[model samples]
Target: MISTYRAVVLTRNGGLDALELRELPLEAPGPGQVRLRVRATGVGFTDIIMRRGYHPDAPKLPFTPGYEVVGDVEAIGPGVTGFTPGQRVAALTVHGGYAESIIRDAGEFIPVPEGLDDAEVTALILNYVTAYQMIHRVARLRAGQSALVTGAGGGVGTALLQLLRVAGVQAYGVDSPPKAGLVRELGATFIDSRERPFDEAVRKRLPEGVDVAFDGIGGDSIARCTRAVRRGGRLISYGFTSAVGRHGGGDNVGGLSGLLALFVGTRLLGRRPSVYGITQLYQKDPSLLREDLSQLFTLLAERRIQPLIAHRLPLLAGRAGQELLERGGIRGKIILLRDVPKKT
Candidate 1:
């Protein structure tokens, strides 16, 4: 077994510069854990937020910053079952995934089908799970209902569109013009987000407004989504991308306050439109996470859904990947690949 491996470490909270490639010590999995030789790790906007010290779940500095990983099990801890070395798997690390090897609780690792690409399954762990939970668990989105997604060209946005399509939900996606084709290709009607008054744009497309509006861009965007949602419709806010770097940087106080006020206003005014915030980290049920991931994996194995992977970079290029994601205009997930060590 290797004693050391390379990982993308976040030395401090800052921009892309904060991400550094470092050699980290490798250790065997303890009881109930398994060690994986990571093949691919997913880069996400959440990683950017964590690196910027904006996410409440951000780990202490001098730690790795990947949220998801796909790999082959190199070792299994004592008392572990249902897995053996050489089995392929994927996991949601929440952190500590940007490395050549990771030791995770066996319960956290989900077996991935043999034929699927590592990068593809890695994308499903965090992005797809978040989208799945929001669409099915939180919103309970039903067939034939219409849904609107802001930042529809992004990782979660695209995942939402794919799942919405499978669920037979008519979908509208708001993004910049460059992403129009991608949005349409993903089975969503594309509305240019650059257009002012996003709600009006949405209304122009759907006269009755949408049944559900998914907003990751927080701030006034939440209010706009509220307006775009029909009475009795729901608006789910999962991120504060719009509020980032505003109000003294990284703090989403303004956006949270806006969402809170909107929720209260809707309740008091009997508007019938409701707003809900989601943070997957706080979910109390581990079974839900596992179930959602299993469903996604089954869908993937059946070729029912395809995850859009924007780019694949070497493990060392994590910073560049983050910079690209931050610059925007990417249509899908960015994956980082690490070379597997040859068996000794």
Candidate 2:
């Protein structure tokens, strides 16, 4: 068993400088928990949000930031079943995934299929699952319908496009100019968000508006995108990427209020466009997350969908990875490899 491992700890809320790489003693899994020798961890905007002390669910300082990991089970605690040491698995951890090894509730760990890339599996846990749930569970998107995905070049945005393709739904993606080709390759009609009047750009194409609109870039963007949803359509707000640099240290009350007003106003106009804000961490049922992850794994095993890996950096490069994500315009998921050989 490994005695000590390197981990990226958030010493305090700030920028990339807050992330500290330190060697720490590893702990054994308690009952109903299992320890994993992490192979790779996903680098996401949520991590940055937490680092900036914006995420409401973020833990106290000196915590790890990764939300998902793919690794082999290194040890199993008492009362844990359905898994054995050396089994490959992927688990969603609210934190602690930035470490080379982590202990998580056994229920949170899903056994990964053999022959799948670790980075791909890591991508599926958070980004793909969120997209799948939003489209299938929340929006209930149907075949032949149309939907608009804002921030459509990022991890979850691309996932939405891929899943929408399999469902036979027409997808319209809003992203920057440089990501236009990637959006097209993922089977979505690209609309450059940098262009003014984004809502008009979308409505001009659909005319009657789309069946649904998924907005992760919150703030006024949500109100504007709501205009692209047809009557009886749904608008799902998953993240507040636009509120990142705003004053007041990540409190998004004003932006959320604007979104609420839009929803109310649309209903008063008899449009009945439903608006929803999603935070997967607040989900009450663990089984539902497990089930969703299982279905996504099946899709991956069948080669029905593929996750785009934008960059793969060593675990120690956590600071640099976060910097890259903060710069924006990334095409897909950035992953941190945990077991990479260290420099001599």
Best by TM-score: 2
Task: Tell me the deviation in Å of residue 14 in model 1.
Answer: 1.1
lDDT for each residue of candidate 2 in 210-328, tens digit (9 for 90 to 100): 88888887777767777888877777778777777522256477566656745675675444454442344335667767888889889999988999998989966778888888777
**Over the stretch 1-344, how does candidate 1's per-residue lDDT look in tens digits?**
45898888999987677788888788989999999998899888888878878788776778898888888999999999999789998877888878888898999888887788788888888888888988897789889999999989999999999999999999999999999999999999988878778889988888778988888887777777878888777778787787674223654577676667467754553334443333444256667777888898889988889999898888667888888887777889999888533448
Residue 101 of model 2: what lDDT?
Answer: 83
Clashing pairs in 1: none
Task: Give all candidates' CA lDDT scores.
Answer: 0.82, 0.83
> Clashing pairs in model 2?
none
Give Cα distance to truth, residue 100, candidate 1, Å: 0.5
Runs of candidate 1 with Cα error greater than 4 angstroms are 245-248, 251-253, 268-283, 339-344
In lDDT terms, which candidate is top?
Answer: 2
Worst 10 residues of 2 by lDDT: 273-282
